[model samples]
Target: MAEKASIKCPSCGTEVEKPKKTWPLIGRPARDGSRIKLMIGQFECPRCGRKFKVAVKKERIPPEGR
Candidate 1:
């Protein structure tokens, strides 16, 4: 199973749902040269009307039932 990602609004402390759109980060080199990638998501707070960007690291994990 995949874990659900969530973020809290800094202005109002309200929990915001995961972003509907996500874009992969490119052209960045890792120190260890790992195959991991970073994803950036933009979201706006419904209550406070504030916009922010959230960075999420992408990784591969085995399924829970395995």
Candidate 2:
């Protein structure tokens, strides 16, 4: 496993599995100087089958537990 942590589905609050391939990325840099991390872990809801994004940086709990 690349790394893992707890991350709930924004739509269903279902604890989703964080895969190693799900590398964290900046959602998109703002015209301003600041940027926000986005929900790199995109998934198709097994129940709804709707594409949705989820933020893992905070809940992903790095291996080092940063």
Candidate 3:
């Protein structure tokens, strides 16, 4: 059984299924287009047959008591 997940895309705001095996995915959209290559698994969007990258933004910790 696959675990249910809810996540939002930083760009395009496209809603997609978050598969359990895709939890550790690492990908980035192609600079020229929407061609995406994932490090965890393979997937493609059904809309335009383009893949969306799993871009992760690290939260910076502000200096405490500065």
Highest TM-score scorer: 1
Stretches off by above 4 angstroms in model 2 are 1-15, 18-21, 26-39, 59-66
| Cα RMSD for candidates in order | 6.5, 8.2, 11.9
Give me the displacement of residue 52 in model 1, in angstroms.
0.4
Candidate 1: regions farther than 4 A off: 60-66
| Lowest summed lDDT window (length 10), candidate 2 | 57-66
lDDT per residue as tens, model 1, 1-66: 987776888789888886656798654445544445568887788889888888755763333342
Candidate 1 structure, TM-score to reference: 0.66
Better of 1 and 3 by lDDT: 1
Per-residue lDDT of model 3, residues 1-66, tens digit only:
954444444345555555233434434544543433333433344444446555332222333332
The true-structure Cα RMSD of candidate 1 reads: 6.5
Q: List the residue pairs that clash in candidate 3.
A: none
TM-scores vs. true structure, each candidate: 0.66, 0.39, 0.27
Better of 1 and 2 by lDDT: 1
The per-prediction tally of clashing pairs is 0, 0, 0
lDDT score at residue 35, model 1, on the 0-100 scale: 45
